[model samples]
Target: MTSTGNIRPMNDKKYKHSVAVLISDGLGTFEFGIAVEVFGLTRPEFNFPWYKFMVVSTQAKAVNASGGVSIAANYSIEALSVCDTIIIPSWHSYSDKKDALLIQKLREAAERGVRFLSICSGVFLLAQAGLLDGKKATTHWKHLPKFRRAHPQIELDENALYIDQGNVICSAGSAAGIDACLHLVRKDFGSQIANQVARRLVAHPHRDGGQTQFIPNPVAKLERNAISNSIDWALANLSEQITIKEMAMQAHMSDRSFHRRFRDTTGVSPLHWLQQARIAKSKELLETTNYKMEHIAELSGYLTHETFRVAFKKRVGVSPSAYRARFRSD
Candidate 1:
């Protein structure tokens, strides 16, 4: 997603909603751009009241980024006062020292009603300012050990894409920044507007802040490779009552070993994996054909309508009927 050497509001009368994006040395241009793309870009198509964004630095001058790139920061720390929302994109350990004045300004800004967000390593700066005390927040998973050791009082959420405790929003590593920024847009506007923007950006419209951030996750891919032939066989004959033992035999493993290995391979248990796949297949039938739920449940390998409903709700976040209502047949 980098191009040309990495080339990267409105006022709701109720909020006036000006956002101050605080930048410092070694900032991640990509993270800053994500904030700008959502907040600064003029999206007349969405016809929404957009936010005003300001790029403020610790000091008003050219600052050095990682890899020795220089960018100008025209605004000073004084801009914090008028901001309705404040975003801190990142902080890097430059010569192993953080700017003290920057932490003071973050403290001052938090004391006001300004909404706060820290993407990736920016949580370090926020935690240093003591704004995250007693609030559940997330950062890049790599920083969890050090962050907890530094601020044990702050509740750290490791599994989520992001976490929103009203005034404060913290995102997991890099991509979660988009999820958080889009979420702020969705919260201010509505699902229709958010979906429109997601279409423009070619990103998902709705990801709950609590969605899991998969780390490395070679286990799923490796297991899927081993179980590929079996999965294909199961898919072709889903109408048959396929037992776990049958699948274990196909993968050439004992039932007990298959149970442990499958759970380790996928984040979920074998039953949940089957249920997830079944729910996806049923949804396709629901949209393309006039199949009844009972029929779909049977065809999709779900044993009963009640079991399908429970599994569908648990995995898809909606009932089959509700999903079809929201989706188009075409």
Candidate 2:
């Protein structure tokens, strides 16, 4: 019935955070599992406190998940008031009638500054609660049309993998939920801890929330592998002055062909991907090492400190020094 795995740690230290995953009937098991795997699992390997996670529902009744599975909540909706964050894994449907009691609870939690994160269509609940009014939100591409029609007041970002509006966050379909959760972990703990959790899950450490959600055309297997290999090579050589010609050579394709395929596979231009990769590398260095801005810029493939500063500020909305001071792991 009720499950509270790893909510209690070995030591008596207070948990640094608390999370409540709200579930309902017709749940997306994969999304629910993502929340559980990321927040509910205990990591004794880490020295710091982890989240105290629990499942909550509007009622104590068991809900039906996909594939004929049933899950019961560990706590009632009232438990949400005590949580630092509340995760809505999935909801019934856009057409389903709103739950007034649950909506009231969500509004109350928002007023109290509890962070709300919704995966996929679970955003509908937040939208119904008026918590996402005038705020940008995203959902599975399939649900975008209905969501837009239903909540014209909410700004819909169909291309984004997730949108973080301060206390409220909404993620796109399925795997994108993992990215959103990891982003939260990175924000709350640090990149190092988030990366460690990502490693355990065998997922990418970070994906920019603004990154395009899906590639339009799927490349053939061989072509896909070639594109993947090129990305791997680029990541390995972030410090090098990588050119489109060089990346094409690595992929064994003509420059034009490589560019097309890379965009088709990754949903972004090759140069844009490179810039994002370099920014990611610079962020890791900023958070982990005491390297000066010039050194970090060099390591992140920028030839000049001015170029690095401009790029970092444009993409991250903060300067290198500010990012380092805020997110550097002690």
Candidate 3:
């Protein structure tokens, strides 16, 4: 037994989940990459069970990605109705006609309790199929205008990074796809597996999608640029005290404007954004390195193990020790 009292790895059966990414023409390359990276690749070292990712097309022939990149799918819509989880990467441009028959396949799966995920404009396809009706959802902020007009029944959340409304989930835009996928992994397997995958991908392990997506897109004024610079600086000095006043001062904006714009920019409050970032740092340490919890707490900006415990459990729904015990590969 480890001195930290983390549990021993369970002798549990690996769940060979069959995941299918439902693709159409004009799929976003980055969104599709999320599906491929999460469930498509195999890592022998991580051990345990993994998913069998299938790229399924609605047509018989080839499909073109958004950037004109062509993809060869292994199956067709027939497989979409049969997978453990069905991911709607993105709907083709709204100007295009969404095939009714293809929507039916995904709708059937949703009705049968199959896990459904949508990235960017893909929520429109789910909305058109009536799967997102009366459910809270989101998509690329730019698409919100047409999306809301087309489907008023679905509750569209503009500020969220991704909202997992149980069986169905939606992400805001291209990059938000990572947050949605990581949330899916944590929900299915545990924090351990999700964190490991993030490490392998060398990406941010956690970013609360609920973090606001309203940051001005074109990299606005010099002040906004300062905010961006401050963000990078805070991340490098996470363990340092990061207060709203301090961040605002660094960005050269009035505290009130900084507060409003920070939420506008990141979709999360400054404190929450930092906490999520800190938690991600801590999760990485817990899984890949054998750092003691005390040191992890210090590095992650918690003043003590008890504070880290409460914060970690509140955000992740698991005790740090328990998470490490059940998921650490070595």
Name the best candidate (by TM-score).
Answer: 2
lDDT of 3 by residue, 9-30 (tens): 2232454677888776788888
Model 2 regions more than 4 Å off: 1-12
Per-residue lDDT tens digits for candidate 2, residues 1-330, read 553344543254768788999988889999999999999998888887888888998766799898899998887777776778999999875475978888888899999899999999999988889998879999999999989889898889989999988899999999999999999998887678889999999999988898889987778999999999999999999999999899999899999999999988887889989988998899899999999999999999999999999999998878989888888988
Better of 1 and 3 by lDDT: 3
Number of the top-ranking candidate, with lDDT as the measure: 2
Go through the candidates in order and give each one's C-alpha lDDT.
0.73, 0.89, 0.79
Candidate 2's displacement at residue 225, Å, is 2.7
Q: Candidate 3, which segments miss by more than 4 Å at Cα?
A: 1-15, 95-98, 217-267, 274-330
Q: What is the TM-score of each candidate against the true structure?
A: 0.63, 0.92, 0.71
For model 3 the local lDDT of residue 215 reads 62
Model 1 local distance difference test score: 0.73
Give every collision pair in model 1.
9-50, 9-51, 10-50
User: Candidate 2, TM-score vs. the true structure?
Assistant: 0.92
